[model samples]
Target: MFTSRERSLGKLVVERFRKRRAERINNLMVKEGAYWYDNFITRTSLLEGLSLLIPGLKFGEDVNDFRDLGNSNYRALLRALDKLDDHELQFFKTFINSHFYVCHATNNPAIATKKDMVLFSRRKLIEQDIKFNTYNTAYVDIAGLANDDNVFFSLEIGARPQKTIPGAGGSRFGNTYYKVAYTDPSFDFSSLYLFDQALMDIPQCKISDISEEAKAILNSRKYTRKSICFYGRKSLPALALSIISATRLLPERDRLVLLGCRTEKEKKRTAALSF
Candidate 1:
């Protein structure tokens, strides 16, 4: 019923709309896949990636570490990593160094107790004349550290609760339950190395170094939904560092929240402290 010119214009509009729709669908799929990879598959992928990067590394003796073999998610992460160019790989390394923490707890009689006891940073270990075995380390994200409520609880109890342990089969290694703990606050802050070089340590801040400005920023309704990236030997110092770093690293619009703690005392301590 339309003129030829009108019909041509209608067809062009339809084509453009279809193209945009397709792009939107594709983007959605990509995002969903990324979410799956990050949440469900990243732990296995990280272990596998470390195995690939390090020639003779073994997670545990007499255990098949790659039990998640044939998993589609596992394969997908490896494929993605394999496709990265040198520059991309370097960027990935930088990202990992910035966002991840290496937890080194052990049951080795020479180094630590029969049950895993949380130790200080590498610098602290050296200062105390303790020898560490790097082969028996676990890599975890900083965000995970901020989210775990039981870190202090496990330390207080001297054993990780059964429910909180990583796998259903119980501790992976013999007599050693790997868990992160809140480090001692009394240690020298100058020597404290919470994370890699990408994250700078606040050399002078103690457990109670939080500023009023930082507290206000966190309490603001605008930032209520933001996830805080904590860094410190103890809770308040961690909170303070996260607030300080967020000003530079995170976007202005994002919120910053603290991780969970076990005790009312710890909570009260954090609440009472201000700089």
Candidate 2:
């Protein structure tokens, strides 16, 4: 387990890294006569919340330009100017100043398509997670019925703080305990997904950037006599490729779903990076 200090430091490191990434995007935008929105949360979502605080602002627009949408951009920019306790307003400023730009683009999609893509992507990911969880639950239930063994599950990942021996100094009471070692219990069944929210929160510097300890736990998992699946429906090509490759040494029955795409019809024209 990581100490509170360690967790705080980790969060700080991630925030700094993301801020640097944001700055890089901002530089690119400035060079190209565009601006970068650096908010982790999307602008439209923030606008939806702000609509409750402020009035007479229309959320629906053909062009989706905040500045042209009856002074929404100006109002948000003004609020951020206060630099008061409004973090949302600060983020709103970032979003507005960026010209609502994300990455470099010559021809952005229509507002409807953009909104549809966002909504569809979120819904598909959630549906995939639900299916994976259902499979995991069913596998455990069958195993328990056969062997009468208890199974436990947790959606959380990462280390938690534990108190160690009392500290020798003032102000501090005890040493922060760290989980130096990890072990994968003889889980009747095990599974992993590359695009899980917890793993997605990690920066992509390297696999190690996430956690060496968590990786060790994953690497230690045995697939023999158990069902261990890996999902990658939402991973980028390079990431999906790497994750799929890692599954080669696992048990043969362990399922691995890499990137896939289909353009069936107008409603479900799916396109994604694949390996």
Candidate 3:
């Protein structure tokens, strides 16, 4: 088992890594003439397909043939993000990319209001902490199951989505997708931590205070302060991590004796593959 502190560190690491990765991908896509809000069919096809795959949003009627979102909430989101600095911009983008899956996963359209998109996107981070035991480890050959009619359903959605041959039960099947990201060197998870909001939001002025407090707590239990990373979640990735690693603030490490728990959950639903 790992401690909460350790788990938090691990999560922060992964969160930071993914954020950098997203920024890199975004820049690359832009360089290749891909914009997120553009009407370019092949470019925005992923979001378009998502709108179709999800239950609430209709193809043409609800979202203008998946080209334009009918709701003003997306515009509102753009406005909100427009005010952020580059550093905060990357952070927000990374944060949203991590939870954008939830937007489509919603079951109720009336309840799946535009506000719900942001709400679920923000809440999914905490939900991740409670659900999984993240580790600085790597996994290979990972596969999971999902249903065709479902939105980001878990791996245990039962049966294959479609059958290769026309048969009696072919219509009742679900889809089994492999975790290809795991195999990708760029999506490495070897140093990921159990994530929490605090790790992402902590301020620098409070770092020394927290470090002192942590030391006192550990000393009472015969533990010593080791190294600590005062990143506070704005840290950029290194060259080995991604091409955009140098775009953000560098990570800081401190020595402190941190304690936490490493929890383990059943391997029920595997990685989410909405592609």
Candidate 4:
């Protein structure tokens, strides 16, 4: 049997695979401006959390822009990385290597479909991780099951939660109603922002020294929905767009997901290029 430390590494390996693959898909979707990208997470059963403390952070052009979302998220990533302290980072390396880091079958000589692999197996690994951590600083509650049936998960995507940007009020007027209520092993869905503030953009960029056309283009943009109900009947393309877009940036190899381009042709043309 694997040691406790070894098992944590194993989970990271599995989570990382999906993340890497998702990044590839995100880049393609971004380039294509595909309508389906945002809806994936917004409409599906996927779960995500928001940091309540985010509203208090100061905001300005220096941080909240479309292109800068990645930069903002990078800051969040640094915070999460800092949270690791020295002990966590040292152990994280081993966890990355102890598993099937790569899905050889997807890249094999025969036919392929990554989305198929995700539905068939990849997603099962991520299982409720989206909702695992209800608070900014806390541990996730893993629903332990057998390895093949393993549903345990956590976020290692490395993006920090954006706490500086204002809501720019995603066009709605209401007091926030989401809360964990309580923390435990079982997961619960409630009111929350879909992703981090870094991923969500408040509509204020084009209003600056840009043309009316540019303002229209900026206004056209929207953030992903904060909550998704798989049991429901709505299709949230916008939410999925943000989630998938965010997913597309995961580290490579074991972190690949099924969302990326299924063909080599697609992969080569739209693969994400880190800046």
Best by lDDT: 1
Residue pair clashes in candidate 2: 1-179, 35-98, 36-98
In model 2, which range of ten residues has the least summed lDDT?
A: 266-275
TM-score of each: 0.22, 0.17, 0.21, 0.20
lDDT of the candidates, in the order given? 0.32, 0.27, 0.25, 0.28
lDDT of 3: 0.25
Candidate 2 off by > 4 Å: 34-275
Identify the superior model by lDDT, candidate 2 or candidate 3: 2
Per-residue error at 76 for model 1, in Å?
Answer: 41
Better of 1 and 4 by lDDT: 1
Q: After superposition, how far is residue 87 of candidate 4 from its true place, in Å?
A: 36
What lDDT tens digits, residue by residue, belong to model 4 across residues 111-220?
23652322122233246343222232122111111012212122111122111223652212122211111221122211112322223444343222234544344335
- Model 1: how far residue 166 lies from native, Å: 6.2
Which candidate should be chosen as best, given TM-score against the real structure? 1
**Candidate rank order under lDDT:** 1, 4, 2, 3
Using TM-score as the measure, name the better of candidate 3 and candidate 4: 3
**lDDT by residue for model 1 over 1-275, one digit each (tens)?**
99999999987787667445434432332232221122323235344344324433432322111112112223433443345444334433332223212232334432355663544443345577867553332332112111111111122222333332336533333344443433332221111212221122222322333454544543332211111212122333333333333333323332122222224443333322211
RMSD of 3: 22.1
Q: What value does the lDDT take at residue 264 in candidate 4? A: 38
